[model samples]
Target: MKYLALWFFIIGVVLIVFIQFITSQNVKRLTEGNKRLLAEVAIQNRLRLLQNDVLTVESDIRGVVITDDRTHLSNVNDKIESIRREVSALRTDLRGEHAETYITELDTQVGRKIVFSQAILNAYDSKGKEAGEAVINTGRGKVLRDSIVQAVHQLDSIRQYRLNGIISNIENNGARARFMGVGLAIIACLACVLAFLYVVNKGRQQERMIQMLNESEKRIKEGAFIKEQFLANMSHEIRTPMNAILGFTNLLRRSSLTQQQQQYVDYIYSSSQNLLTLINDILDLSKIEAGMMHIEQTPFSLNGLVSSVQVMFADKAQQKGLQLTINVDPSTHDTLSGDPVRLTQVLINLLSNAIKFTERGFVHFEVRCLSQTDDEVVLQFRIKDSGVGIAPEKRKAIFERFQQAEAETTRKFGGTGLGLAIVKQLVDLQGGTIHVESEVGKGSEFIVRLPFRPIQNHTEAFAAPAEAVLNPVRGMRILVAEDNQMNQQLIRHLMRQWQMDHVMVSTGREAVEALRREPFTAVLMDIQMPEMDGYDATQAIRGELRSDVPIIAMTAHAMTGEKERCLSFGMNDYISKPLKEAELYAILQAYFRTADAQPAPAVVNLQYLRELSLGDTEFENAIVRQFIVQVPEELGLLQEAVQAGNKGQIKSIAHGMKSSVAYLGLTERLSPFLHRMEVEAVSGTDENHFQEDYEEVRRVCEQAVIEARALLSTSA
Candidate 1:
């Protein structure tokens, strides 16, 4: 469109130049024709003047016959000669044959008249009487006058013709100029229209493109939001079941069990580990999708990594009666820098799949150093298996999430079909490439190429043979603040097997009560409970009692922000339930170690001391003696507060008693009654709730006192 407009402009400009040239030429021709007409008119006027001169001479001659004046005749002769010259010059200037012929005839006639006048003048001079008589008879003067009139009339006719022709040409040229001007105007209008259409069309196209881009952007944002929500929910759902499996397996491990029971426990533990792996894969995939996954560069052993992968698959390959082989190029350095976790994840996925699919032949891995520079080294790792290889058409789709080669393959070889997808994503995240070469029923080989740079300072060496073992929790008093009976029992049994003592309570109220009556090393608080939750209980203990006891929160909800929320609510640590024993033991060990190292004995076990009152009087008195010996001043303050009916002071004393009772395994003895009393004193509640709780706590404390007394007596 623009090209067409440009061509039109160029053509219009050329036509304008041509029109100006033609108009200029026509103007020049008209100006020359007008000049010629004016010159012809002037020559005709001269001829008229010459005729007048000849007539005047004739009249003079006629008059002079009576009065003979020779001087006048000479003057007339000179005038006639001058008129003849003017006529000849005009004839030469008019350069047309017909006009020249007319001028020549007139000039000849004028010459003849001149000659007659001159002859008369000569006759008068030589033989004046006779010559004059002869010329008067001839009548030459009248004839010459008549001829002059005819010549003048002819010149006027010629001038009129020329003038008419000039007028006609002027009219024609004016019409042509008007026509050209109109054509130019039309072309100008067309150019304007074309330019306007081009601009409008361009603007419309740009607007449509912008609209499409906006729509695409909106859809992309929507997709991202949905994906984020899905990942969050999936993380929670996956982790919930995983926690239960791991926690129960750990609990079962501590029990005295038969061989079959141990196998079942092992199976649960292994299955849980597998589930955890799958969850991690899903998380990695989510991170990759969100563009948040990053590689950690550190020094790791390349040879050791390959060796570890081989060893991981060795047992599985041997169980299937297949040979497993590993080959590493000697040229490759043992230590290189890269993200070992992600790299190991990719290799393990490959090797594990190879071992699982290969039934009888062999599984092998090879590591080769492709090239090396000062800063970077390129390496190729290959895992090959003699198994049911993927079909040609299905190979590409295998790298897509949740997609297998076929339904039969998925069924025969059970998998989430996410391994290869995760491996591909991880490989790409590390700026690496992966490819597979295989033929159906022959074998398959998976290759990965990665680049690594060496770390300047390395702190730890790689160890492949070390197994992750759960750290032992020994002689730690744990306060189990759980409402669920089964969960409480499970925690209690697990703690017992680890040689750690625990006080179990049903509610947050009981947890606070136990904390009040005795000193506890740590509190394993459950988040959701009747009356008060772990959050409120921790708040109360931290606020009123001024206790800084470490509280490890346990919750069933494993949402994205739940762990942070638990920690925010005054919990020293958090563990999601169903709980892993390792997590619990670790938290306990961390807080207990720090607490035990403190110089001062921070708190007393008041409830445990109170429990010894129900046994044999003397033994109970001895236990009291030991208690007073340890914290006599604090006991006096407790006694004073109880007598004064100061509910705040009573709650504080009860909190002290709860912690101490838990340490002595007498939580059941005093916690319930102390909790009821604390609640009544703080809120001024009705006596009914308090009376019932106090009676139960009194009975348990009495029994605990009797038992403690007998044990002390026996020791003595």
Candidate 2:
């Protein structure tokens, strides 16, 4: 290491010295070039001026002869004085090999040209116009002017040639300097790297010994990291598709199918759900181990939680020839403040294990109040089951990951042994503790004691079923930013099924662009994408675009703290991947609760109608009534035309619809979709986006009709 440092220091010094040499060379070259350039430019400017002055004086002499205008002779002497000054300046500035010869000739020719011009002007004034004209026609003055110009140009050429030579030399010098500097710098870097590698190789023996000594400790630390990575990877890779599977399965089950097909689909759905549960258990255990699990303090109903858990496991328990029962003390607070999700997870894991192990006896779940206060309660959960019991010495081990009561229990019972471990972890995360009591021949009772706050303010602590809760007052134009094709399709199906309007974009950047171009009630942003991720998109929409269009993160990550992380990134809410249609709709519903009662921002721009009416109220009323009556019928005919491939009717109806929407000032929104229909009528290409666009058109026009009808009613 010391040798490597010394070598690096030497290389650094060399690099610095090389840079200094190159920079000094560049400075010297540039200074010389600049000084020469100024001198050359100055000389050239003087020559140009000297030539121009002589020409101007000659022009004045000719003007005094031709028009007899004395004003032309006004500046001739001042011009002569300027000419003399320019010749003097050029004499001082020029420094070429023939500088003296060129300047002497230029001075002489300039003097002769001025003398000729004065003679002509004097002839024009004293000897009359014919004498001056004759002198000019003699061509002597022309010869003098030509000689002056030739001398000035000769001097300019000399300066230009010298300047070009100097510039070429400077460039060549700079090129060489740069080439050498780059070569030396690259060599220095190479030497430094090689030396470091050599020294490290020499020191490897000691490093290897030290590494061997701490290998176990390193692995002990790495085990936790590996588990963390595994948990995160599973959350994204497994749970994302799992969210889609469960969501689409829900949709599939709703459709008509044969009995056998429905049964097969049910089996697939059950297996997918079970796989999802296992993935969640593993993630939960990892989160608890990493201290990433967070317990919420929201008010929830204890009875409702228990009832839901019972319903979840009742069928399984019955199929196993075991009864599932739940009992909550009547004195227990109806609204207890704790994490219902985490608590439900705990209850579900315990009950699942109870049912999994029990074959003959009932698996009894009881929630009892251990104690109570003004704002807090201690609840006791007893999950007792007549299952294969744990040995006295192994009860604690069963709570550890992947540990079963006996090694043979896994093979015999067909389980991962993660259920109990997850249950204990969940309880412990919520400031709770778990204990077990059992004998091998009898059963096991797992008791959990948890502290929760009682809510003084009564709240409706349970959500209704997804189907019952989804009552959207009006379809909101939502923008969905999702990358997964299947997930996108799933969300699309859900949106279409609910009769809500949505636009799908594949990336965050597209979502932001779309939002910027139009108005949407909410944004469903995906976390991972190609152009931009959800977090950055939300930030762009909030910090850059300054749009507070309720951004909900559609992430594949369902790990602990994900929701809070999303919230911190300016996301209003988050839905895990393989989206549950109900959860997605509910979150969207919350954001648009007020918007449902309101009309769209672009609903019906009345300015177009008002302009056409020109203060004629009756005309406006007639138009509005015609719109309310004719638009819906036209929209229906358009749909039928599209479905029936009536190209002529499609174009005719779309053109008419375009005019109708244009009259209502919806051209920017509705015109594009109607235009697409016209194109599709002609081309008839594309999967089905035109249909979705038609749906959007229909939705907007419905709102327009409602508002238009109200306008007429109020006017009447």
Candidate 3:
């Protein structure tokens, strides 16, 4: 249809142009003929004027001869001069030889007539009327006058003949012009109709194209949804079996096994860890591609973070007999606000790569403060290694995901090639840049520059609290809510190994029922379960049972927003599946450590708040009190928004509270639910599930308020 419309438009334009071109040519030819006709008429008029002037001169001389008046003689002279001037002017418009001959003959006859008239005038002036009459009667003047008239008459007859031909030609041209005008008018009307049809057809085609685009968009959205679901399912299916393999391997290594058995278990553990790393890298790349990865800026120790990343590679470096050294410039500050985790991750990847490729010599890590001000700090990190350096041509390709500098390098030093890619992404997320200087077979150095907001007037930076000797929560019953059989056994084994009394349930509902029947020191809630999910179960425990027992979220979802989602559902902390022994132990230690040291339980860490207040005890107290006063009202409103189905309002409130939660160092306990609520609110799908989710967040907030007040009272 669109093509047809275009064709119609083209035809209309071509027809109108053709008609105008043809009509203009005809008009031009007719106009040229009319000019020639006008020239002929003008020549004839000049000849008549010359003849009249000659006759007038003759008449004026005769009048002078009769009246014997000098005025008449003067008039005769003026008329003769007028005839001469008219003849000269008319000669320019004359064309062919015949026309020129006629003009020349007329001039000759007029001159003779003028001479005769002048002779008569002179005779009349000197001798009077009888002498002039005698001159006129000689018949010479009459002959000249008759000859001039004959010349004039011949010129007029010829011009009139030409004028008649011009008139007939004009009539013919008029008839043709009328006929063409009618044809052109018809063509113009047809062109207009065609153009109108084209416009209408084009409009319809545009509507069809719009409809097609809408359908394509709908299909694309559906495909994206399917992709998300596939990723989620893949994550669950892969992690479930991996959990059993790593968990049982951990159990086997702990048992009194032979050295050979322990070595085999170690291989299994190592392979599982590698697999998990690969999975995480793939998922991270996916999140980045989806634009869901967010960089967090929080106050952290810059030097401490570097040291920690350095420590991560120390074992591998030592295994390879490589010396690792860290040099920090004296001007570098200790505390800055940035995403320490991402920064550390990038550094770890660089150090690991450096350590992996280097056969000998030391790997040096250097940190320097490039610039500093009261508001911002720019720092540079350089990782230098004695390794098989990359080729100049391959330096850029190395940063691309799943691309290695050389195929041989991949076979020699096995890697997924995603390390540098992730590092680059992480650096960019922090608004930093990474560049490399390398020469093949010599060495390579990776430099990173990051800008961070300074922690102003900060006297001391927060460090991790020293590890205290832990004792199990004796006589305290712990509840584990998990659906996966392997995970259940895994948690059960860990709890038994720690010599703690615990109960395991396969569903969230069973866990909640058990919690109601007996008090537990802590609850481990798995997010996905068959009967009553962890969210609803936690809400039951916190709202219906009114229990404040610390609940930790356990799940296979290690995605970007998963932790926040878990915390928002009243969970005090979160840990991913295929859990590490140390991470599990850490969580247990945090809950159980205070059982022996503190006189009462401490539900919140006040380190962040205390640091923020800059040692002002009054300010800390006021801030805590504000959190206590405002959170309940915010929670109530959040609940109302959820009930009203206002996801935007819910997201806004949750996001606002997230900052306070982080400032107070309550992120582990509060972030999961709040973050999940905020993220889910944007989707605004599954309204019933969202309502349940919000209820869980409200319950967590209410519990958090109670605990925060208790901590504030203790601090006071």
Residue 69, model 2: lDDT of 73
Candidates sorted on TM-score, descending = 3, 1, 2
**TM-score attained by model 2:** 0.49
- For 1-716, candidate 1 gives per-residue lDDT tens digits of 66876676666666667767766776776666566656655665665676676677677777665467555666765677677777777677666645776677677777777787767766767887767767766877678767866776676567667656766676676677667666765676576667667768878988998999999988987887677667755665555556656767776776789999999898889878877877777777877786657787644556545544554555577679988888889877655767776898998999888887887799888899888877988999999999988889988998999998777877787788899999998898889999999888888899999999843322222222211122223457888988766676678767876788889998899999999999888898987778998889999999988998878887765444566787787887677765655445545654553333433211223333334333445533444333222122223334455555555555555544553344234444456677766677788654425445544544444333333332332443
How many residue pairs clash in model 3? 10
Candidate 2, pairs of clashing residues: 243-578, 244-578
**C-alpha lDDT of residue 568 in model 3:** 82
Error of 1 at 212 (Å): 6.9
Badly placed stretches (over 4 Å) of model 2 are: 1-230, 373-376, 455-472, 593-716
Candidate 3: global Cα-lDDT? 0.75
TM-score of each: 0.53, 0.49, 0.62
TM-score of candidate 1 on Cα atoms, chains taken together: 0.53
Per-residue C-alpha lDDT of model 3 across residues 244-265, encoded as one tens digit per residue:
8888987887789888888898
The per-model lDDT (C-alpha) reads: 0.67, 0.75, 0.75
Pairs in steric clash, model 3: 564-671, 564-672, 565-672, 567-672, 567-673, 568-672, 568-673, 568-674, 569-673, 572-669
Q: Model 1: how far is 222 from its true place, Å?
A: 4.2
